[model samples]
Target: MTDLPHYTEYDTRLAAYAVIRDDDGRVLLALWNEGDQPRWTLPGGGVELAETVEEGAVREVLEETGYDVRLDGLLGVDSFVFSPAQRSNGSERPLKAVRVVFAATVTGGELTPEVGGTTDEARWFPLDEVRGLPRVSLVDVALGYLAAG
Candidate 1:
């Protein structure tokens, strides 16, 4: 028998996010505090194994921002691959992030910061001011989708 080369195994993370805008042209955002430099991002997170993407989006938003949201429509999908060196956890294998974005509207609940979670605070920012704030690339991606429509 011939010998074969070994291949590294990688992990893929599937997450869901929402782009929520009010009538006042303000967008809802959450502060992702898991890294050394916290940055603003859409209010959502990883999809649980047992839940659908839509259900996960709603659950994450409620958990992070204390808001009940109704997904209006599908925005788009964003995918990125992180090399081992770029991963925060320093895993040997590359990681593929598949994010599902959706257009959402607030149904109820008040703005509240997430407790003991990856996100620390949630707030609304005027669309014009959002460009000046520190934020993750996903924020820009989601905004681009909104602008396209």
Candidate 2:
């Protein structure tokens, strides 16, 4: 849990994880399904009770992206307060979500479209091309850690 926007009693909130593949400075991204528009995002999901944040990240990557990964390091966190118009699943989601982003590696598993959850598609976009694409700035933060390493 890195420095994140606080969400206490303001509204419903949850914690999530973000996993970035260290590509010697490049990154892997996919166009997501659970967004207002098609947005490229890292692999992750909401944290479940009785599970650690890192474990959630691992499970989420496999579930959302069809890849078994191991958490390598903590990149940082992102706390988002979304409007109902932009909420994923199209309901009033948590007022905020503290995303515990991590740097991870592909341990095994084949990438396929079926594993893409609600995503329209799954493909890895390089780091340099990310900013130009329709992606959130949080992706850039994850990329910065990858570049430093």
Candidate 3:
């Protein structure tokens, strides 16, 4: 349990995309595996070198949730200071994380799970449900952005 592959760390920072969708006035919320923070979050991950943000968002959505996403808009940028508990790789360090939220539409894809996905489950949640969750503020940020559009 001590030795694990953490997706995000302090020294090895990462950028993630917050994929959002509007389905009958609801959005998709994935119970993402954020290592120690283990909570429900949007699907996303680090941006690859030479890959644009939009590309990263799409890729992350597919990789994390097995969903092919079409980026509709960007929600916002968020920065978080790494804490001792958030380290997923079973390392002792704080992880500085930067995430770019995006409003995307599910153009085509199936609701499936990534191989060894961080999330144990994925499901659709209303904006109110997202707002009430006790976890990172990404969902709220995404909802606000979605409402803006």
Candidate that would win on lDDT: 1
Collision pairs in model 3: 6-88, 6-89, 9-95, 10-95, 82-95
Question: TM-score for every candidate vs. truth?
Answer: 0.92, 0.76, 0.76
lDDT of 2: 0.68
Evaluated at residue 79, the lDDT of candidate 3 is: 74
C-alpha lDDT values of all predictions: 0.94, 0.68, 0.71
TM-score of 1: 0.92
| Per-residue lDDT of model 2, residues 17-68, tens digit only | 5655456655667667655577877777677888888888888777766788
**Which stretches of model 3 miss by more than 4 angstroms?**
1-12, 34-37, 90-93, 147-149
lDDT by residue (tens digit), candidate 1, 1-149: 67622334678899999999999989999999976699999999999999999999999999999999999999999998888888889698888899999999999999999999999999999999999999999999999999998
Candidate 3 lDDT (Cα, 0 to 1): 0.71
